[model samples]
Target: MKTMTRPRYRLAIAAVAAATALTACGGGSTGADGGLPSNVSFGGGASGAIYGVLATGMAEIVNTNLQGVNARAEATAGGLQNTRLVRDGELTFGLTDPRVVYPAVRASGEFADEPPAEDLRFVMNGYPSLYQVTALDPNIRSIGDLRGKRVCTAAGIQTAMLGELLTPYGLAVGDLSLSNLEWTECADRMKAGDIDVIGYAGGPGAAVLIQAFAGSPTAHIVGIDPDKATAMSAQFPWWKPSTLPAGTYDGQTAEVPTVEISGGTLVTRADTSEELVHQFLTALESHFDQFSKVHPLASYYSLPGTATNTMSDVLPTHPGAARFYRDKGIPGY
Candidate 1:
């Protein structure tokens, strides 16, 4: 929403083994081990999206590091969508963006008409990326050029942000031939010459965007005009300035200006036991090596900025996660 903080987190990882041991004290399904419950479903982003990949990687990390636990990442819509799933109990935990969390908690912005999911709780926020608007056509450059193009965006925050992305340039969501298809579908359509542009945000090496780069040498990132960036910050102040630096993705030699999006926040319903969440965090830290192995972009998950300042904060932090944070002396509880 409008008041959400620019998602920032700094995981306090000064001592890993001790932190892991302390957090892993009991919990999980095992009577003998501090492992998570079996077959837990983790809400990743929509299939083939960055969140999906990250969730899948996390599942593996949970599996490899925690015994008696069978955590699995399930493909779901995305941050905002996952928020609902977690609240409804269909998902045990989910990765979400602060932008979605703020609005959904208070039932404002796009959620102003929707009911609030009051049970959601924060785990941690880390890993961030910027709005990377891509187009294979050389004619597409500024956000205004997207006016008549078939731009792919899914439901939830994607559409909301797209609307905001267009406003500074005097374009609205209606100005574009918008496609609300899933991430993979959008990528497929782009390759089939059915779509003109797609905008997404994630760390430097998201798998889906990388595939787009490999599929077409013509793929190039579009940069927002300096004036537009300033204008966007003025209205949707939650968005902080960001840049997809040169060489972060293939076939690009110049930095493209953009706005930052929230990194992943592992969350669950308030009813989830404190012990379970605590063990989950413990496993997460203990398996950092294996987790990072899932993707180059996973490197962004290291403990860092983890709170919502851009968005309004009415949701309470999970007691388990909060306990761990306090124990570690991590900043920005």
Candidate 2:
């Protein structure tokens, strides 16, 4: 048999933990030693994606540090799916964005098919999911420049957010020839001159952006003009102003102004035991130094940032998480 690396071995252990935890997805059973669940099902993002990697690392940390709690990260279709699963109690914990959770709370936008997930509770903050507007045409300096150009917005959550982004410029998705392709396909089309622009959202060093930028010399990320970014943030409170500093990517020598969702909010049901949530936060805090090594995006997180901006004001923090932060004197909690 081939030798499995340490990471792979950890994930294999988590897979077995997941199988044992499946029956407990409805709401976990308390462990004998503590009020915390004996098994935990954490809904992570798409398989092989960055969010998935973060979720896997988190579970590994918990399993290694938090005795009596078995945490398993399960692959999911990203935030939207994770939100629904968490709301319905099919997942004990989930990773998602405040933007995605906000709409689900109101039962609007992509979540219109289901009732409002009013019970969703924010546990912790992750990192920014900044929108990177890239184009192969150097002449496309601003969003307005793509009036009649072919644009690919990826699809689902991204398509909706990008459509909203165009509104401040007096442009709509209909104004451009739109394609709902996947990020990989968008990169390919952009390279082939089939698409004029790509609207994608992810952490700074997202893999798809790296692929798109490397494939075409002309492909470069464009900044959202300042006024538009401000207006968009005003209209969508979940968005925060962010700057993509110079040299963030190869050949990109200047900073770019952008608006991003404070993504990676760890959410759970409101009824989750306060002790359990507190214990969960404790486990994460103790392993903070090692987390960045597990995933680079985690480096963006800080106690102050997490306490104040993990989720929007509209979403309430669980009492357990709130207590944990308060005890640590993390200011905004």
Candidate 3:
């Protein structure tokens, strides 16, 4: 294991720049219903990303099922920016990871410069994004095995989570030659053999991983030790134990142990009227089939108990969403 001399992590400057540029833009105006906006916007994340794709699907579902409500997905930077947008009411709802919003809620991490988003509220849980430690090297089978390897991952939660994942193994991000690049670029570098490992967070069959795998015949997902996976879940409730079943990707024949955090979460401000949130959930549940058809990852939200399976302890559910879940007889609502 060799430690690098330079800093290990770098924030995604491109994403921050994108968020700054879009800050001046605003969503639709409020409708006649108790300050609820007539045109609802969901922060879809960077265009064509999984979260963005799912957000677009959700927008269509709302536009079709809810009367007089115009919903559309807006292409923003990513989760962190989405949280800021939702908190400022620029976006009616934001599809982001639970952990991504925690920083804003507590005014820590990337959001340390901002005020605590006390009004941030969860609308509903979305698909689970598993932390996939993908590597083109077949020998890289565990987290500790990357000590001296070249690594690449996106900024924000992925970088932080990867650091945390390495901590218990007595390694740090600095131990590897790490670079922070967008997922697409990371895949490109993997294809070029510019990096040995590319850690990513997305759905099991995420296209990014597929592309990275296609770059090399030896590309495979490295499994987290089962005991470490359990420890991580117990330590961080948002990181529940999950498995990438065999054949999830080419060359991945054995089930790989991993941890998953559900995101694609739609969150709104607490002040958004109860009626509006309730109506949105009703439409989503009613036309789940149509909504899921928008993207394969969208179907994950249709799973049993999806509505209330959010990070309630961090970002509490909005009254509107809670009421809807209670009416549907969901426990813990």
**lDDT (Cα, 0-100) at 56 in candidate 2:** 87
- Which scores higher on lDDT, 1 or 3? 3
What's model 3's overall lDDT? 0.78
Off by over 4 Å in 2: 1-24, 29-34, 310-312
* lDDT (Cα, tens digit) per residue for candidate 3, span 1-333: 332233333335656655664455554434446645667788877676777788888888778877777777777777778888888877778877867787788898788999898988888887768889988777887898999899988765777888877776788888888888767888888899888998887788878799898737888888888888888777666688888889988877889888888868888887776787888888888888788787887777753556754567778888888888888888776
Q: Candidate order by lDDT, highest to lowest?
A: 3, 2, 1
- TM of each candidate vs. truth: 0.72, 0.87, 0.86
Model 2 alpha-carbon miss at residue 288, Å: 2.2
| Residue range 1-333, candidate 2, lDDT tens digits | 111112345545654565444435554534445477777778886577777888888888778887887888887667777788788877878888877887899998778889999998888888888988888899999988878888886656787788778878999877888888767888787788888888888888777778788946787888888889888888887777788878877789889998888778788888777788888778777878887777788775557666764454567988888999999998766
Alpha-carbon lDDT, every model: 0.71, 0.78, 0.78
* Candidate with best TM-score: 2
Q: For candidate 2, give the lDDT of residue 50.
A: 74
Candidate 3 ranges beyond 4 A from true positions: 1-36, 215-217, 234-237
Give the Cα error of residue 246 in candidate 1, in Å: 1.3
Reference-based lDDT, residue 198, model 3 = 86
lDDT of 3 at 160: 82
User: Worst ten-residue run, lDDT, model 3?
Assistant: 2-11
